[model samples]
Structure formats: structure tokens, C-alpha cells
Target chain A: MLNYIWIGLILIGLFVAVGNDIIDEVQNPYRNGEPFVSTVLLKKAPSGIRQTWEGDLVAPPDYFNGFYGTQRTQEPIRQPAVISKSADGTASLTMNITDASPAWWREMAKSAGSKERLLGRVVEFSVSEDQTSARVQVVFESIRFVKLKAVTQAALDYAAIAVNIALGLIGIMALWLGMMKVAEEAGLLQVLTRILTPVTKRLFPDVPPDHPAVGAIIMNIAANMLGLSNAATPLGLKAMEELNKLNPKVGTATNAMVTFLAINTGGLILLPATAIAVRAAAGSSNPGIIIGTSIVGAGCATIAGIAASKLLQRLPRYKKAMEV
Target chain B: MGEFLKNLVEVISFIAIPLMFLLFLGWGLIKKVKVYEVFVEGAKDGFNVAIRIIPYLVAMLAAIGIFRASGAMELLITVLAPVTGLIGMPPETLPMALMRPLSGSGSLGIMTELMKVHGPDSLIGIMASTMYGSSETTFYVLAVYFGTVSIKNTRHAVPTGIIADVAGMLAAVWIVNLLFR
Candidate 1:
């Protein structure tokens, strides 16, 4: 299943990227080689014989929407731009895309070879009588294969991010592992495990309820319920290690491990802190309104996950996977 | 009642770690367990464990990142929308449900965007936030936890995770529509 899903993601991603690129190629939505005729309000006239100009690229909202074939922007375009003339008199326009730039241009600029700037050929430029405004027709740089470029970049970036996430875990993992070690050595874990044996005995009947794995599992679940994910992860990993100690087949998951994981993934938290915070940040009047709903959702997930894990472990295939 | 519950949990969250540290170490001290040496002995394995899971994490995350960046999720949403719409789920929040199990940050981004577009108290926003809270990032959890123990050929974990995620998402949509609609 994991093999199929992993490969499925990659295959689907690549196929969709190629498909979108093909559609973009046929559509030519970026209007490659087509001139964008607009007016520019100059900040100041170029001094002396130097043929460089800097100003605001102005376009009415209707014209901009019509040009882009969408109504993504409601306001007029007043993006800052610069047109530079070479010694031989050929001119080019460069617009640095900022937050003020229209969303379409930003999307185009991001897909451009440059990350946040749009480069274009300034085909025609004429100064107004007042020397404060000019008419310009620019052919913006072509954007192609945007999704493919992003997919390639994401593959590389996420690999590095994965390494960073693992490395970041070292400190917390060490802290919790060390504390749990001391607790284990002190015989503290057994006392807790004993108190919870009746409950865990049913959940993980294969393992002795008094085992240290039970202790770590309890700690992990408790921390998770409290929404302390930082603490929960190391503790969960510790539980896995202890559970693996009981695995007859080293590379295969045991029934107890699967059950424990089902509970972890259920994500039954007392308070969904991140969601509430985001709601509050989004100016919600009742950010806490979903607390009950989240609990209900997660509770169902937890119960369903445990039931599924228990039922699935009885299947012949999963049972065979446990064969040493 | 909700406010009280929220406050109580907030206070507990603040104090839980410090209290655990004190209690664990304090108990170890009274038991004459050589707490420092024992802790250092256990801490020695942390670096190895962290390094050991790099490959698995990279494989899982890169696949998900590619799926996200390719805009396949949007296409998936379009396909799944009508089917899900019949179940009382807003088509817009479908991304939240789908992304929830795949990537944590990605789902958060979707939830935030949904809230921005629709006020956070609206049905879509409520459903999206509930979806975010409903389930863990199952793939990530599986990768890190199983990676730690070098478990491959995950027999039923994937299906189990999918079942849980589906149930959670459905529950989220059901309850949100019931209460918020």
C-alpha cells in the first residue's frame, strides 16, 4: 500500500504537471510576443542624452482584466516599471513585482525565469507633450511550464526541509529520551504502567501491560491530548522503539505497533490550539466555536482507527506479513 | 463551559512540561538512580535516531511536496467536489480534508486561505478548521515513527490511516453542518 501510494503521488504529480504545461502551450495565456499597449506616468524625465525611463505602468481595470482574460484584479494597475535603452537605441522594460503588483502579473513573474521581476521588450515608446507621461507597447517575457518548474523545485526543496525537520528533532528528542530514561531507570514508568494496565491490557493484549512500551505509549497519548506535539513525537518514537523490542519480525509492524499508531493518528486533542489561533487571527468572533466540533471529529477518528486496526490485524495478509 | 474548558487546557498546557520535568527528575533523585549519568546515557541515542530517519522522511515529504506543487490537489478537489458536495461539504473546504493527512503546513495554508476568503465564523471556515483539527498528518506520522524503528512493508497502516482520516473528515463535515449551518 505504501509503495503504491508513494509512486502514485509522484506519477500523478508529473503527469498533471506535463498536462498543465501542454494546456498552457496550446492556450498561450501569457500572450507571448503580443504587445501590451499601455500608458506610463513618469516619475521624472530621463536627464541628458541618456535614454532610460522610470515610472508607473498605468492601465485601467477593465483593460487590464480584458488583457489577462480574467477579472482577478479589481483595481487599476499602477505598478512601478523601468524602461532602459541600450547604446544602439533598442529598449527593454523591467517591472519589479511587489505586493502592489496585480496578482496575474505576480503569478506570471513567479513563473518567469526571474522570481519576482517581469522582463519585457519595450517595442514602442513615445513621450507626451508634457514629458510627464508616455505611450508604451511592451511584449512581456513568455511563461511556460509553470507547474513543471514548481514541481521540480518542490522535489528538491522538500528533501532539504525533511533533513532540517529531522535535525531539529535532535534537541527535543534528547531531552525527552533522557528524561524518560531516568524515569525508566528509577522504576517510575512501571508504577504508571501498572495503574493503566487494565486499559492498556485490552488495547495491546499481545504485549504485557506492565511493559515499558505501555508507559511510553501512555505518555505519548497524554502529551498529544494536551496538544504538545513536540513532546508527543519523541515519546511516540520511544514507544515505537520499545514496541519494536517485542517484534518477532524486525522489519514488519506488529499488531501492538499498528494499534498504537492508529491512536496517534486519530489526533484526539482537548483543544485544537492551532486551528483556534488561526481562526482568531482571521478575526473570528467565536474562535472557540469549533472546539466541540473538532473533539467530535477526532473522537470518531480515534474510535474508528482503533476498531479498524484491530479488525485489519486479523486478516491473513497482514498476519502473514508478521511471519518471521 | 467552553471558555472554562479552554482556559483549563491552556493552563495545563503551560505547566505540563515543567511539572513533568520536575516530577520525573525529582523521583529519579529520591530513588538514587544516578539521574544525570542515566539521562546522558539515554541522550546518546538521540543523534543516531535523528540521522537514521532522514531517508524515509525525505522520500515521504518529497513525494508530497511534488504532489502539492504540481497543482494535482486542485484537480483532485475538482474531481472530488461534486461527490463530496452531496454529503453537505462545501466544495471549497474539500482541499482542507484532502490536504489534512498529506502535509501539516500545507493543510494549515489551505485553512488560512479559506478563512481569509470566507469569514472564519462561516460554515466553510468552521468546516475547514474542524477538518484541520480532526486528524493527524498520517503520512508524516507514519514516516517518522516507522522510520525510527526501520519498519518497511507497512502492511495495514496505510489503510488504517486512510480509514481514520476519512472518518475524521466526514465527522468534521457532518458536525460542522449540524452546528454551524
Candidate 2:
């Protein structure tokens, strides 16, 4: 049931987030509170008026890779940082996290105290004899509960995204629905339905051969095959509305609706345009290579879906749901 | 043959809509139907239908989003990786198979990432793209369609969709391995 599946996702997500945080707590992958030793190439020296020193923190790729136990970066890390000593003599380091930062640190920077810069406490700063470079030991601000924070953000973001998606559908939905309305009014649907009766009658035995729902269903499936999704969705919804009229019980699905939805979800398309486009963009030698494979896959899906819908509708539980 | 088929479908897709519009409205004119008034009358339902599905979509998508962001998919792939070899599936594309039925954008992201890491002509890339084309996002269609109709008790629709998704994914794996591998 949707209730169980929905709740399962929420519960599993919450538990996994907590579980991941716990694992992170034990493993300490971020090396929180651990001193990081690296050399800085100082660009600006302290003057009489200012004790702030600005430099680029540099680390060899091998050292970083070894420390993180990851092969995330090949280029050396050279990130700009400012070290300023307070009147009490404790120094703090602020590093602007840029695109050139190691992938691991950039990920940590997302949850850092400052979203843009990584804040760290200078444990020991020893200037080189030439005064142009220094070796520093610094511990970055701790990062924790990453997955949990992401989970919360995603819930909020997806809710807004969902509304945006629906709102965006208004224009396309209106366009297709209007055209479908005209087709229905002009006896065009009846003529098409008549042509597809043998197929529809077998696919949906419970529906009358001449039902308007049959017309919408045929149009919807054709739209789907053509990958005209803007048209398919509106037509499919129209089909659902018409199919609902024949339902003996309100708020429950009939055999015809199940069959129709199965076909929709099967998604038997003549061409997989999105995939092909992406393949071409990704520079495939044969971008349209998946056409045959996709057709075969979708064909199997359609047959399996139609067979499953027919077989499952006969079960006592599904049949019971249909009863008034 | 492939080039011809591609061009043929391209032409059809290009002209199909305009031709359909001309035929439908022109036929309406012949039949004495008040095309504009009838069109506006029917189009009015579009806003209502779009608005009605917002709640269902929010509920479905929010759950899926949480699941995705929690890094649970990675854990799932780790667990399912061993069984992938039994089905002739490249372990890397399992995420595509899993995400396809849940979220359209999520599966697309996986497909693109797979092709980026592996060359587009490689077996993994081809299989991932094929998997993307295999099936519709089942849960999304379920939410939107049933939400529009306000059908709370979906009965066997969920199972039917799951079966279709599984069949589609398996068929993609099977065919891709048969030809490409």
C-alpha cells in the first residue's frame, strides 16, 4: 500500500541519516579536530599597522590523497588563506574554498561554519627563514550530521519543486486538453475508437466498445509512443476522468483504469529521444544505438504489464476493492 | 536502416502536432462545431487538474528526495552489487534500474553520470542509456494520474507498475548484454 511505502521511505531515510552520522562519528572521516600540516606561500607580509598575513596554502596531491584515503584529486591544492593574530597572540586561519580546492575539502566546506570559507584554528605557525613561506598546523571547524542536514534540505526543496512542476504543466495541459476537446466534439474520437475497437475491446473488456474513454486511451498511448509527453500527460488525465465515469464505486479503481495505467507505465516508445540526445551530447559514436534495445525492453514491459493487470484484477482482494 | 528510421521519426515528430491541429480543427469547422468556445470550455479544467495534483506530487517527491539525499541509494547499491552479475547487469547501472521507476530526474542524473565516467560507447554507457529508455517513472505517473482523479484506493495499480518496471529493467539488461557484451 502507498501508506506503507511512503512511511517506509521517510522512516528509512531518517534512520539511515542517523546511522550514517553515527558511523561518521566513529570513523571521523572528516578528521575533525585533527591538526592538518601544510605549507603556506605567504604573499603579503605583516606591516607595523597590520599583523594579518595573506598567503596561498599549498599541499601536494599525494599528501592530501594519503590523508583522506581517497584519490579524489590529482592536481596540487593551492587555496588562498588569511592568518591574523589577535592581541592575545592566538592566530586563526580562514581559507576561501574555491573550485581548485580538493573535492573532499569542498564537500566539507559546504557544511563548514562559513559556507564559502573554511575556518580553522592555527595550532603552530612557523615562518621559514626566507619569510616567504611557513609551515602551519591547523585544525578545521568540525563537520557533522551531513546526511541528516541534506535529508532535511531535500524535503523542503522537493516540496517547492513539486509545486513548480505542476504549475509548469498548466500551459501544456491546457493546449492538449483543448485540442482533445475539439477532437471529441467533432466525432473524430468516435471514428478513431471504432478503428481501435478490436484492440481496446480485448485490452479493456469491461469497457463498452464505443466508450469515449477508449478514444482518450488510444490518443494517450499514441502520444506516449511518439514521446510527445506534453500531450501524453494531459490526454492520459483526460482518459482517467472519462474512465472514472464508469466506476460503480467512487475513489476506487476499476479494471479498465488499471489496464490503462499499466500501459502508460510500460512506456513503449518508438524512439527514446532523451536518451539519444544525452548520448549524442556525451559524444557517443552511435547515439541512436539504444533504439532497438529500448524498444525491446519497453515491449517486454508492456506485455508483462498488461498480463499482470489482467491476472491481478482477478484476485479476490483487488476484485473486492471494485465492489460497491 | 538506422539513419532512415531516425530521420523518418524526426519528420513525423516535427510535423505530427501541426498536422493534428489542422486536421482536428478543420474537421470541427466542417462539422459546424464551435471550436473556440468548446476549446476554452475544456481548457478551463487544465488549471484545476494541474493544481489538484500538487499535494500528491509533493508527498511522493518529498519522500523520494529524502531517500536520495540520505545516501541510502549508495548503501542499496552496495548490497545489490553482488547479485547484479547473476543477471548479466553491469553493477554500475544498478542505480539506473532502481532510480528509473522512482524519479525521472534522479534516473537521468545517474544515466548522465554513468556515461561521463565511462565512454558513451562503452558497455556501461550503452546499458545505462538503454535502461533510461526502458520504462516510465512509475510512481510519478501513479501519483499524478490518480491524484487528478482523486482515487485514493489504487488497488492493484502499484503492483502492476512494479512488475512492469522490473520486466523493463530486466529486458534492458538482457538485451544490452546479449548484443553489446
Candidate 3:
């Protein structure tokens, strides 16, 4: 029955991926380009307020004014600007000019009949004194401006659809299992009981090793640690069911299950794969830090969870359940 | 003292990462498939898991997007400025801290922005790196785990998980400070 549910979910996910075009949207490689000022260097520094690119001199263009119109060009080209070289011979150059003020930026916008304000801009050049004709690469590493809302909105809409489909598939599978009652008939309960026996004993030593509720608790934790929360639901429900099975009265919470849920919710320390994925997505040079942190952080949390549960169990109400 | 402990941790980490990967490889091989196949299967499982928890992931990602898009993250930076200042943490790292709980991708986006804003060697960038190392998606874990189990009442789970998250955050900050500062 579980196998069928798994197969069903796999099919549903495929259908959603195809039908909603979520796969395409997620894999979309569209990037936004907004207009912003960048610095470009010239063979000789312009005397007026103009942007310059920094780097080794490439072959001089026939005309600098052709690349940038006369309106964009500044006067009084600066020369041999202070070139600071690092130990590796990577030189940094800066251009000093007085006319390029915030007001000049505002006036430039006003002259262009545009309402948008101009942000600061700078040009960097790398000049190889030995190789006067070295190829110059004008790298634009930074830009500041607004983003188009339509593109972002479309991207998010596709993400929403994808998430909906995933939830729908998981929900359908959970309902099918609940309706069929395969959890009881297939002896999955017994399997879980056997699997969790030692784990329950080790994690919740205060509870009797042979307690009926231990199996359900362990199964739930295992499911969660594996990042199979949907699979964990039945185990949690079954654990609750078993806990109630032991309880003469229905609806009364058991100490063991509460502690179990607490620890499970606190989560088990297998690996922090989700965080690692995020780190990788974020473009971190190292995504492995999550592994160490997961061990230490989750390990600590598990200990704290156990300690808290034990401490809570010592209270009068919990003490009564422990006696059983 | 902290430096010694950190170096010790790094040395242990150098060994543990490879060991863990090898163990996974061994398990895959014992299952009678090539290691690459096993890895592919694992990756496929990850995709399935992502698909399964899409709603939760989306909500968290959207929240993070809103935080960034609406400039709430900037506000958070301002609010945390004094506190971070006292702790020797830079104001620029507040975005990364906020991103840690919501979406790993979102945090990474912020991390990239930070790396660009401040060079990789800057203290804030290093702390951001450490925070990325230390934290997990608390709500995503809850949603996936709880949703899987169909458990209704969160009870003590939320509090305990948050506490754990706080511990992870503090540990990352402390560890980075001790090592770098």
C-alpha cells in the first residue's frame, strides 16, 4: 500500500511538472538588465566630468566620442592617475575630478527630461607600462537600480504552482493510507516497533524499554531525519494511536509520546542537507559548514530536548504517566 | 583557548567529511549500484523531498523574498546594528542571519550580495559564512516532518526547535568571532 502511494506521488509530481510548466520556470535562465552608469577608461583621461574604465590599454579606438556621445563625455582628461599595485602586480587606478557633483548628476537627469536620479559612478583602469597595447577588459562588477516587478512576479507564480502540486501529491497519499488501514494489517506497526526498540531505550531511558509507545515515536523521528515528513505522519499518528492503545482512556496525552514528539520536532542529527542546498544555492565557496554545524547544533538540541522532556516528566502530572 | 578548540574542530571536520561521504558510498555500493548512481538516486530523493514540501518551502521562500524586496531586511539591519555593534559583529551580516531560518537559497543570495558589498575577507562576510554553516531551516523542517506525520498539535515542539535554532546562531557567531577576531 505504501509502495503504491509512493508510485502515485511520483506520477503526480511528473504530471505537475509537465502540466504547470514548473520545471521550465524553475530552470528559466532569464536575467534582468537595468540601465546604470559604469566607468570606462580612455587612452588619455578626459578633462571634463566623464566615466573611465581601468585596465591595460587595448588598441585605441578611432574615436572615443563615438563610443560615448559628446553629452556623456566629461572634459579635462586626467593622466597617469595614482596607480596602486598589489604584491601580485594587480594595479588599482583612481580618477580625481571636481565637476562631477550630486547636483551635476541631478542636472544631467533634468537635462535628459528624466525624473530618475543618478547614482555615483567611477572608472577603473589597469595600464601595463611595458605593454602599452595590452588588451583592456572593462569589467562592470557593481550596479545600483530598480528591478522589474513583472519578471519577479512570474517567477514566484511558477514557484507557487510547483509547491501546490507537491503538497497535493503528499496529501493524496496520506489520505489513501488512512482510508485503507494498511498501517495495521501489513504489520508495519510491528516492523516499526522492532526497529525503534533500541532507539527508544537509548533516547528515552526513563520510559520502560518495552513500552508500547516507543516504536511509533522512533519511526516518526526516523522519517523526519530522512526528510520524509509525509511518511512520518502515519508513524506519528500510529504512535499516538499506540499511546492511546496503552491508555485506558482515549484523548489523554501520554508522557512518552509528548517527549517523543518533542525530540522528533527538535529533529534528529543526521545531516543538514536542506541548509547545505540553500548554501549551495546562495553561492557559498564552502557549503560543508552545515555538516559540522548540523552535528553540533542538532546534537545539542536533541540532548536539550531529552533533558527537557525528562525534567518535565518529573512534574506531578508527567510523573503519573512515567509510573505506567 | 577558543582558537585551539576551533582548529581542533577543523581538523576533525577534515576527517569527518570524507568519512561520511565514504560511508554513504559504501551503503550505496552494498545496495549493488555504482557510487555515482547512488548519489544520483540520493539527489533524486532530494528533489522528491523538495517537491513534497513545496508549500512550506514556497511560503518560507516568499517570506524571505518579501523581507528582502520590501526592505524589511534593511530595517532589521538597522535594529540589530546596536546589538551587533556591542558584540563586535558588523551590521551587514543581519541579512544573512534573517535569511538562515527562511530559505537557504535566499540566504545564499544575501551572502552573494554580502561578498560583493564587502570582500570575502571582511569580518561580516566571514560571520555570514559561519552562520550559513551553523543554521538550518527550522520551519521547513517542522513543516516537512509534521506534514509527513499528519500531527496536529505542535505543543512543545515549536519552542524546543526555536531554542535549538538560537543555540546554533549563537554558536556560529561565537565560533567565528573567536577564530577570526
Candidate 4:
């Protein structure tokens, strides 16, 4: 299923890039003959050339809004490149705002209406000496696009991501899975199972009351609740394996498995410590403020997951397969 | 009120990580289980599962790279922005919404980028972080877990998972606006 989507993306991207005149033929480093690499500029499109000048605005410049249409209709804007400021006024600044789409670029160009409206408070606004034109020449540059080189580069970067993921998982997986083993051996699974029985039975009517899968599922959910992902995954796989043993239909997901998958994907977060850590590292004045919001949002997701899973099972397609 | 809630969560998390280990070990000893051997056995299983998932992870991640590199993601977001905007989603956070289900690292990267552009305390940053915290990497989880068991026909899992993801994204926008904005 995903294979088709992957191919479609590559093919469609190539087609679109060609049509949009974004596919640039570049010299292939490996080949001696011709330009083998086709680089497509996706997001970075130059709207137009602006008179580049350097000076402070008499006051903060009023942001233009036309390019951003409405909440739904707006195109994404690239973060403007910052110029290094000097104590003396000599830094170069470009008023041209390149956008993701050409339409937005045109909108930006049109929005730079009058000098009195835009540059009244600005100390300096002039065209750079490189160009003879005083008019703001709209130049479109597409920053985000897909090409063979980018696709290959992106694929190559995955190896590093894979290694990092594995490396990060090793210690956590060893520790958590080991402790989970201890929990199971210590009868904590049974304790947790009993505690979760009522809820699990309602969600998974197919499973028997005394099945070991109930315990495994409960423990998996518990680990997830604590943001113990290293443990949660192995435990989840373990639970799925146990559930598979009970499944009469091979290669097809049972109701219980689908429900579990949905719940796991819903992922109710209690602390969101990672996000908070990121906020703190990023210099947020109040890192923990997001925690309450996290709970509300995740709580809604989990409830939605449970409801969807349960309701989905009742549909004719799923209900018709019920084991007597 | 927000401060109190934050402190409460802080206290619980601080105490929980240690207590969890203590409870497991203590119970194992009390039950007279061979805790060390059982743990070793389970860790071996964990190692094997991790090895097994690498191929699935590669497949999923590679697809994500292609999709992202193609700029298909931005296209999708642009197409959906209007409808999403009506529901309170900011256009800036659209990429994260699209990426959250398919790839974890991808969404995290976008979240980090958004936080950098708009300060973490900004509305966009809070919304991105909230969405990040609430949703799971749906396709990644399904691929790895289903691969572990070799489930060929996922039946209704995909739609169900997507439903949850959409719900999470919407809730993130709503909750952040209410609490922070």
C-alpha cells in the first residue's frame, strides 16, 4: 500500500518539477559526460528582486498580510535571512519575501504598494547598485521541491537516523524490557491485569477473562502511560504475539489487535517530558505550561481512538467475521 | 491553577521512575522468582525484536524521505489548510500534522523548526508541541508492530489510527488556544 504512495510521490514530484520549470540540470560529479543530477526547488522561490539596503526602520515595520490570505488560504513563508548588523549602518537588507508558491509571491509583490504606506518610517530604502532598476523586481525562487539528488540525499540521511534510533533504544530497551520481565515473573502482570480487567473486557470482548494477553496488554498500556517507550514497544510486540496465538485467522488482524493498535497509536501522554525538555532547551520562560495542554489534547485523542476502534468493530465488514 | 497542575505532574514523574523499578524488583524477590535470569531472557527477546524492526524501520523511513523530498507534504498541507483553519489549526503547524502519523523523527524535526522560528512560548510553538505530545507515529507503529507478527491484512487499523491522529491534531489546536492563547 505504502509502496504505491512512495512511487507516486517520486513520479509525481518529477512530473510537477518539470512542469513548473524547477528541475535544474546540474553537473553530475560521478559522470564525466553530462549533467545527471536534476535538482528541483520546492519551497524556496524568489518572489522578486528587491532594492537591497541596510538601515533601521524609523519604527518596527508593519508586516504585510496579503500574501497570507486567510487562515486556510495562506501559503507558508520562509524565515527571512537575517543580516549581520553593524554599529555603523552598513548591513544589506532585501525587502523581497520569497514564498512557497508563485501566487503568494505575486501577492507579496502587489502588496508592496506605495512608498509612503510602506517606507514612511524607514530610515533607508534603496535599490542596490548591482541592478539599474529602482523598481522592486519580483523574482520567484522555489525553496522546497523534490528532485533525484534531494531524494537520494534524504534516503541517505536515514542511515544516521536509524543508527541514532537504535543506539538510543539499546539501554532503555534493555532496562525496561528487563524490568518488565521481572514484573511478569513477580505477578505484577496479574495485579495489573485484574485492575484493568473491567476496561479491557469492554474494549476486547473476544479475549477470554483469564488469558495472559490481558496481562500483557495492560502492562503495555501502563508502560506507554509512563512514557516508557523503550519498554512499551517490546511489551506491545509481546502482547501482539500472544494475541496472535488466539487468532484463528492467520495473516489477518483480529478485532482485539486492531483495537489495541488504535489505542497505542492514540498515545495518551501524561507528562510529555521530552517536549518540555525541548521547550526548556529552547529557552522558554515556562516550559511546564504545556503539560496541562498536552493532557487535554492526548486525553481527547485517546478517547477518540477508543471510540473509533470500538465503533469500527461493529461495522458489517468486521462483525461478519466474528468467531462463534 | 496552571502552576499547581504543573507542579503536581512534576512531583509524580520525579517519584514514579524510581518507584517503578523498586516495585518490580521488590515484588520479584518476594515472589521468589529468578529475577536476574528472567530479565536476561527478556532482554534477549528485546534485542531480537529490535533487530527485526530495523528492516521495517528502513522501509518506512525511506518512503518518508521520498515523500518529504518531493514536497508532496507541503502540497497536501496547502490543500488541507483551509479546512483545518476553520477548525483552529494554524497554517504554520500544518506540516507537523501531516508528518506526525507517518514519521516520528520527521515530526520532531518540524516541531523543533517551528519552535526555533516562533519562540517556544508562541502560539504556534505551543500548538506544535501539544500535537507532538498527543499523537503517535501511526504508520511507523503499525508497520513495525504488524511486521513483528506478519499481519498481512490490517483491515480497519489504518483508518482507525488516522482518526485518532486527526482527533489529536484538532484537540491540540483547540486546547492550546484555550489554555495558552
The numbered model that scores best in lDDT is 1
Docking level of model 2: high
The number of the candidate with the highest DockQ is 1
Q: Local distance difference test, per candidate?
A: 0.93, 0.92, 0.48, 0.68
Decreasing lDDT order of the candidates: 1, 2, 4, 3
Chain B TM-score of model 2, please?
0.98
Please provide, for model 1 over B59-136, each residue's C-alpha lDDT reduced to its tens digit, 9 standing for 90 to 100. 999999999999899899888888986899888988888999999999999999999999998899999999999999
Q: Pick the candidate with the highest TM-score.
A: 1
Pairs in steric clash, model 2: none
Can you write out model 2's per-residue Cα lDDT over A1-324, one digit (the tens) per residue?
Answer: 787888988998999999999999999888889888999999999989668889999999898888776786899989899998888889999988888777798899987777788999999999999999999999999999999988998999999999999999998889888988999899999999999998999999989989989999998998899888888999999999999999899999888998999999999998899999999999999999999999999999989999999999999998888888
**B28-109: candidate 3 lDDT, tens digit per residue:** 4554545453333323333343354565445444444433443344545777778877766677777777667655567777
Clashes of each: 0, 0, 27, 19
What docking grade applies to model 3?
A: incorrect
Worst 10 residues of 2 chain B by lDDT: B7-16
As for DockQ, the candidate ahead, 2 or 4, is 2
Q: Each candidate: RMSD to true structure?
A: 1.1, 1.6, 15.8, 11.7
RMSD of 1: 1.1
DockQ score of each predicted structure, in the order shown: 0.88, 0.84, 0.14, 0.46
Worst 10 residues of 1 chain A by lDDT: A64-73
The candidate 1 chain B region of ten consecutive residues with least summed lDDT is B77-86
**Native contacts present in each candidate (fraction):** 0.84, 0.76, 0.09, 0.63
Off by over 4 Å in 4: A1-146, A163-175, A318-324
| Segments in model 1 whose C-alpha atoms lie over 4 Å from true places | A48-50
